[model samples]
Target: MRKLTLLIPILVIALIGVLSSVFVVDEREKALVLQFGQIKAVKEDPGLSFKIPLIQEVVKYDDRILSLDTETIEVTPSDDRRLVVDAFTRYRISDVVQFRQAVGVGGVRVAEDRLGSILNSQIREVLGADQVTSDTILSEDRRELMNRIRNQARDSARSLGIEVVDVRLKQTNLPEQNLNATFARMRAEREREAADEIARGNEAAQRVRALADRTVVETMSEAEREAQVIRGEADAKRNGIFAEAFGADPEFFAFYRSLQAYEKALQGSNSSMVMTPDSEFFDYLKSDRAAK
Candidate 1:
């Protein structure tokens, strides 16, 4: 019974040791087997793997794409406009051995720190180039700038065993201190445009008014000239009729003139006239009396 008990305990310890020596690597993980703090093997493919029982170690890294969001950085374009830029990178470990050697067991965090610096430098270099203006940075062509940054950063990241898939500016904005000033300038520009439009409208209105006034003056002048011509023609026709009446019968014409004068002299109810007894004004009255 004592020997059996000792054998059973030995078998249990051996089983535990075997279990500790074996590890299963997931497909999403990349593993590095290290012996005495030195890399022994790199396992990229997913399967069951073996390591030394107590003296070896395995460090696993994600094989999938990783994201790194950099802190907001300030950059100045060629146009001399300062901007705050937030950027991000998509990357993966292309060489685990080199990555481990460069970062020295600090893991993804350390790699990201180094890569972030590289990306920031590339961003500044590309965005601050002589041909890159603020308008270009803010325009659709910004994609080209980002691609340039990615390519440039990729060259630098290779030393760190990093593959830069993409580099993008997540947000671009003016500094807080410049926001109010920029808005004020924009407001001033809008106001200037509005004033220009109003001035143009007023000029058009004045032109219309002047044209209408000129048209009205011309129309009134034409109407008055026609009225004068008609009045002159009517007066001439009346004068002709009067001359014909006088030529037809002088006595009747004289009587008609005297009758018109009496009508004018006695136009009011309280009318009065002072005249000599033998005045021509009484000729019509005397003729009427004689006829009676």
Candidate 2:
């Protein structure tokens, strides 16, 4: 019974060693087998792998692309315009052995921190170049700038066993201290444009009003001239008729004229005129034939 008990303890120890030597590598992961802190082998495929118990260990890294957002940083463009920028990076571990050598035991966290620094440095260098202005960074040309940053970062990250697949600027904006000032400048510019438009509109309206006034004056002058011509014609025709009547009967024409004159001179009630009794005006009033 004691021998059996000893055999059971041995069996349990063997089982523990087997369990320790056996390890699993997921398909999405790449692993480095380390012996005494040195990379001994790489397991890039899925399924079971073996390692020495109590002496060897496996460090796994993701084989798929990973995303990282860099910290917001302040940068100055060629025009000395200060901007706040943040970016994201897509990367993958290209060499697990180099990764383990570069990062040691610090793992993904340390690598990410270092990678973020590299990205920030490249972003500043590319964006702050003498040929790159704030307008370019804020325009479609920014894509080319991002490509430059990615290329630079990719080269720098090789030492850390990283492959930079893509780099993109997530947000770019003015600093808070400049926001209100920029807004004020924009508002002022818009207001100036509005004033210019209003002035132009007023000028056009004045031109239209002046044209209308000139047209009205011209029309009135033409009508007045036509009316004067018509009056002259009517007056000439009336004088001709009067001459014809006078020629036909001078005595009757004179009597009719004297009656018209008396009616005009004494038209209103209590109307009076100062004149001598022997005046020629009395000639018409004293004529008894005029009453007939």
Candidate 3:
């Protein structure tokens, strides 16, 4: 029974050792076997793997693509316009051996931090180039610029065993202070345009008013000229009638004229006129008295 108990303990230790020596890697992971802090093997496929128990250690990394979002950075384009840029990267560990060597025990977090710095540098370089402007950044050409940044970042990330699948600028904006200033300038421009429009309207109104006034003056002058012509014609017709009457009978015409003169001279009550008895104006009165 004692010998059996001793054998049982040995079997239990063996089982523990076996369990510790064997490790399983999932399809979504890549693992590195480190012996005394030195890489011994890289396991990429999903399956059971063997290593020395208590002497070797396995470090696992996600083989799938990962995302790293960089902090917002400031970039000035060729037009001297400054913008805050936010970017992100899609990457994966292509070479686990090199990745393990580069980052040591820091793992994916440290790798992403370093990669973010490279991405930020490339973003600034590409976006701040002489040919790039704020308009370009906000245009369809922005995709091409991001591709350039991705390519450059890929090159820089090679030493770290990182494959940059893509780099994209997520957002870009002006600073608060600049935004306010831009709004102010736009308002001023709008106001100036409004003033110009008002000036043009006033000028048009003045021209219309002047035209109307000229038309009125011409109409009034034409009316006055027509009235004068009508008055002159009427006066000529009346003088012709008077001449015909006078040619018909001089005495009757003279007597009629004298009666008109009397009526005009004695138009109001209590009116009197002093005249010589032989005056032609009194001829009618004298003849009437003599006949009676």
Could you say which candidate leads in lDDT? 2
Flag clash pairs in model 1.
none
Q: How would you encode candidate 1's per-residue C-alpha lDDT over 220-261 as one tens digit per residue?
A: 999999999999999999989988999998778888888888
**Candidate 2 local lDDT, 1-292, one digit each (tens):** 9999999999999999999999999999999899899889999999999999999998899999999999999999999989999999999999999988899889899999999999999999999999899999999999999999999999999999999999999999999999999999999999999999999999999999999999999999999999999999999999899999999999888978988888888887899799877777757667575575
Looking at model 2, the pairs that clash are none
Model 3: pairs clashing at backbone N, Cα or C within 3 Å: none
Q: Where does candidate 2 stray beyond 4 Å?
A: none
Between candidates 2 and 3, the TM-score winner: 2
Quote model 2's TM-score. 0.95
Residue 273, candidate 1: C-alpha displacement in angstroms: 4.1
Question: Lowest lDDT 10-mer window, candidate 3?
Answer: 283-292
A best-first ranking of the candidates according to their lDDT comes to 2, 3, 1
Q: Which stretches of candidate 3 lie over 4 Å from their true place?
A: 208-292
Comparing 1 and 3 by lDDT, which wins? 3
Q: Write the residue-wise lDDT of candidate 3 on 175-223 in tens digits.
A: 8779899899999999999999999999999999999999999999999
Q: How close is candidate 1 to the true structure, as a TM-score?
A: 0.92
lDDT against true structure, model 2: 0.95
